[model samples]
Target: MNHGHDLNRRDFLKISSLFLAGSAAISSQVGQALSSTNTAFAKDDREEVVHSFCEHCFWRCGIAAHVRNGKIYKITGSEHHPLSNGKLCPRGTGGIGQIYDPDRLAHPIIRERKGGKSSLRKASWDEAITYTAEKLYQIKEKYGPEAIAMLHHGYGYTFFKEMFKAFGVNKFAKPSYDFCCGPRLQGYTMTYGHGTGTPEGIDMMNSKYLLFFGTHYGENMHNTAVQEISEGIRRGLKIVVFDPRFSTLAGKAEKWLPIKPGTDIAMMQALMNVLISEELYDKKFVAENTVGFDELWAEIQHMTPEKAATITDIPADEIREIARTFASYAPAAAVHPGRRTQWYADGTQRVRAIAILNALTGNYKMPGGVVKYEKFKLPKPEAHPHPHFKKDVWSKYPFFVQTKPENSITSHEVVQQTLEKEVRAWFVYGVNVPETITLGRKTAIEAMQKLDFMVAVDTLPMEVTGYADIVLPECTYLERYDDLDGGRPYRTPFVSLRQPVVEPMFDSKPGNEIARMMAEKLELHGVFEDSVETYLDKRLNKVGSSLEEVKKTGVLVGEPTNLYRKPGEKLTFKTPSGKIELASAQLKSAGFDAVPKYIKHPEPPQGYYRILTGRKPMLTFGRTANNRFLNELPTARENEIWVNPRIAQKHALSHGEYVHLKNQAGIVSEFPIKVKVTERIREDSVYMVHGYGHYYKKLKWAYKKGASHNQLISKADIDQSTGAVGFQNNFVTFIKEA
Candidate 1:
């Protein structure tokens, strides 16, 4: 019951402030305290600490791996790292679970078909690498390098990316782009000419009022964001949340508006109308720093609160009042452009509306408003020359992020192309393909089954690995050296390191080593250094830091960058017009709406409710689905479908009953999910955590734990402009347990 040295809420708050102080002594004290209490460490065992970043999620918070007798016994937040400061999420401490998971892929495996029956057989690293490279070359020789595509999710994919590029195979994709960050990134790029980087650019700690549209910060638990939000709450910052379900974030809000799903743009337009009509908008800021104001006004002039109230289901007076309060906060208030925004087909426009709202309130770069965080200016090392990519753009979408040379297509496009046989080979790295949202689980599996050659590089034997022709066992983050993480943007810009805390277990190898082996087998000359450590040292040397220096604290910090704009400063944006685009010229040129428009999405069919999916605070979908340490908590054990009282009664579902969900396409769930009948959800929608209901037998802890959200997504609405897949259109009906 003690749960070791548990930090109470008050104690956590006290230490949370110390994170900003960047005190090494405080970090040491904290780390020692946690390590001393860990029963797994023996008093006689020699102990050492190694600094690295977490791989549980993309936020990549720094971690301190406490090693006893050459084995990591505990993990704690690194104080020297800017992102985590000294605090870590549940997932960070759960790295040990991943590293020691019994289900982990321990060696290289190749699927052999004998007498039309296929089975995986363990193979030596050289045999596996050689076979994989040969097949990839054959695919390239027959179909072209473009025919070989990769779907990657983790930081480990960097080496493979370079390897693929050296081989002239440029088609790459990340599933996160299709279902998560893509819409918001493209939306902000279209309006502000840049994407909102991780930790987001919100100055929450200094803000008076924060407006959120279904952004569950508490549940999502991005380290810096959560820390700042908690600090902001202590400073008496007011919050307003718009979500159909009363999310953990909504529970902390001064106002929680249960806005109708798929009508966010309408509500945003209504707020703009009120701000413009009531003359509450920052007129001077809009006139001086932004273009297409007239065009934006014209589009939203008739979108009054009264009209939006009917569409969004929030009272007209309430909408106006919220808008007025938001405006009254002036440069301190901002409407947060929420993450995982690919809900409706108009997702990009939805975020654009958020951008326009924030701009109208004159909160572009204010201390308590929206600001652009800077990244550590780590210079890149020279790269080996390779053949130019045959194609610059593979996505059919017009406005995919093109600020940099994008050799990849969208993940959904990859699925479509694979089904079409245009993509003959696939390299899946650290992503569970079937669970990762693309067109759907069925379509993803179909595409994988149709592939001529498929190689999966992962730590665990996830479902995707079963479909692979070759499986390369990748060591867990605690046992790997990845490329330096300098891309994360923050107030005090810092570059974090990911170094091995222990030797890799079993026959599994680090991603860098695997990539180098593959590159060598393919005869790709000079693509990689003699060793991963050498490669990292060379890159770190460019920034006047070495691997040895960074290994001490796991991060190299830079001076804090100015995040706010000066008063009366001339503003220039990266947009074609050189100003904040209230109406995007590029979108218009691409034959799309210049300004965001609220298009009506299809309503749920009779006898069915829309399925809303989110994450549990302790788990991040697939990454933590099989993590035993994190899953030990009561809340993390399994996911349940949250049904409203009205819907539960209509379906004769009790609070503790179990039911299977059938989608609109009549695809029933494989496992029955526990029903949580509560008022937290709307009668028209049911809520469930994603990344559950694993059917893979190898995932012992996660198998048949809950219903899979991805499996129910039989319908997909692709955003034409950005190629992001919108899946909120799918509806589900309950089927009582047999």
Candidate 2:
């Protein structure tokens, strides 16, 4: 090679810069052109379009796809959508990558042997289903249906349970409760005695104050409420954020209280102490609309500000100021209820304290604040009975999830205990377990090992399928029929259709069709198994709409509607006492302290830090971990340890330092992260992202992105009463490695 072929460093640099600028300009133009292309699939530039929803992050926002042929160009949130408001966060806009993922599982596979971690053998659907049903029969014959446990998470529970019932396994639990959104139900139930309404869109557009207890509404925006919150902030709403980390929401808030982790109860109680002591509470509203003010006041009086402030590490004066600010805002001030409650051991109680604040302020069911969650009533699919299992095995606990669905213990605890052979098989669908569950590297193999058989049904051969004995390819949300809960109705209510943009790549089928097919094969086929046409007709006709109608319009308007707040209307709290409970009667009856108290949790050793990790608003755990488009958006294991700089400096720590996080579980992993050491974090605590650190080498990009947070955690410290692991109660201490 000629020496001159290697251009001088300066000349090479100049040429490279020119090339980069040209590429960037070209890319920008492509993005602009792509936006205008109605049919992205056109070979001659035909604007091919497909109507679908973005499943990238599980908010499942509906979208009309632009596809010309087989190639998917780009995606945008359904602006016409009331829920999505024609807007999408970064992930939703980048949803096209999922449609054409090169790594997408393209065929049915059967794990031949029971042991050896069930590698994919590449089987045809005929062979796969035949083997699966046969094993289902064998498992039933050998171990009874109750011996089987189904851990199903994600949406579309209705269509996936056919096999669980057909196989006669009643131990069906969705990881949603364990992995997320479970704590909301628990707190709501404990307070209101009923499952809560869906995540109510905080009417941020009209609110004057927003208190965030680790609530990242803007970061996780999808539902209309998130949009409302953004609008409110734009209009200068006083935002107060309380978290251990200086989160994106916290950065935006007018005030950020870096409270100690796992002691939110103390902070909330301290705020209550302020509200009561200052007499900022709405006495008139409490007297007219509530029932147990005297008792609640008396109980909180015992939780003095000094005690709560001491535990939460929030200055008592600041606590008082926050309380007064919140109380003064009246119905215009609201505390945001975040999704994904399955965090610490005290997760439910923490949420309960926050929800009760609404009641205390007489903000219950009001405008721009604690408003009711209104969902458009859609026609139900035909009520198909889960055919009586050949045998019915029920949980002795008579599981009580405080809120709707996702009681953590009711799902994984059931699965793990049953797999230790307490349960024989698992028929699961609508989720990818290995990704959704914590400590997935271990759980994925262990869960599959103890079962007599395992079947997973999903749109892709997700990580969970690697361990599945039988894999059923299910369609994406766009190619399936399902129920939707959080979208605009007066914006218009209509059944949205997810027609196939392309053929079912391989043996893939929609859950509805899969359920029907399984029903027919299992000998349970009858009125329910007749045909998709008949079932849709039977079910949809009741709601004054039909499948065919939805297919045609993509959605149906709920009609002229009005859900409003009548000013000066009496507020009604949804508790047994019909008032906010400073001292929960349910807590008292459960043989626990009535007041929300901060109890000391198990402490980690001096050398290790207690790592509290959580879901990224950009990517739901492991869901978008594989989508390069979404993964490249932001926060791919930028292992940020939210520590007090005071603590970091003492340990000779610096930002961007690489340190090993070693836990008692013997998990030793190193991360080179930007130490977000700031005053916003507790001196003793740290936090990072979960769902990184993929053990599967095949996951190419996701492997070792960050430490496996679950590895550092010992699930041994579960809340006995609820059986959910107290993720917060387990503690650790930080040590700086030289």
**How do all models score by TM-score?**
0.94, 0.85
Number of the top-ranking candidate, with TM-score as the measure: 1
lDDT of each: 0.84, 0.60
What is the Cα root-mean-square deviation between model 2 and the actual structure?
A: 9.1
Name model 2 segments beyond 4 Å from true.
Answer: 1-45, 114-119, 193-196, 386-399, 402-409, 430-435, 438-447, 459-462, 483-495, 527-538, 559-587, 633-654, 670-680, 730-738
Candidate 2 lDDT over residue span 1-738, tens digit each: 111112211111111111111334434433543454444234345666555566665556667666653445666666545556567776676665554444445456665534432234566666776677677777777876666666765566665564455544556676666535656765666665544444453556778998888776655555565666668778878889888777777877899887776677777777777787788877776667655456656767766667877777788778877888888887788777777665666676667777777767876656666655544575544444455643322433222454333222366566567557777777777565644555333454555556666777765445566556676767555445554432323324444545555444334566777666666666665525455555655556677777666554355556533334577765455567765565677767877656555666665567555676665666665556666676675565444666677778877788766666655555455343346667766666787766665544444556556655655554544444454544654454444556
Model 1 per-residue lDDT tens digits across residues 1-738: 111112221110111111111235323433453455445333236788889999988899999989875457789999999889888988888888887776666668887777756766778999999999999999898988989999999888989988888888878898898878888888998888888889888899989899999898888888889899889889988999999999999999999999999999999999999999999999999998799998999999999999999999999999999999999997988888888898978989998999999999999889789899898998876665466745477888987764673335898889889889999999999889888855778778777767889998988777787678888988888878999999878899999899987666667789998998999999997999999889889889888989989989999999997988887788778888888899998899889999999999898999999999888778987778988888889988889999999888888889988898898888888888899989998888989998998877667789889888888888899899998899999999988877
Total backbone collisions for each predicted model: 0, 41
**C-alpha positional error of residue 76 in candidate 2 after TM-score superposition, expressed in Å:** 0.8
Clashing residue pairs, backbone N/CA/C < 3 A, model 1: none
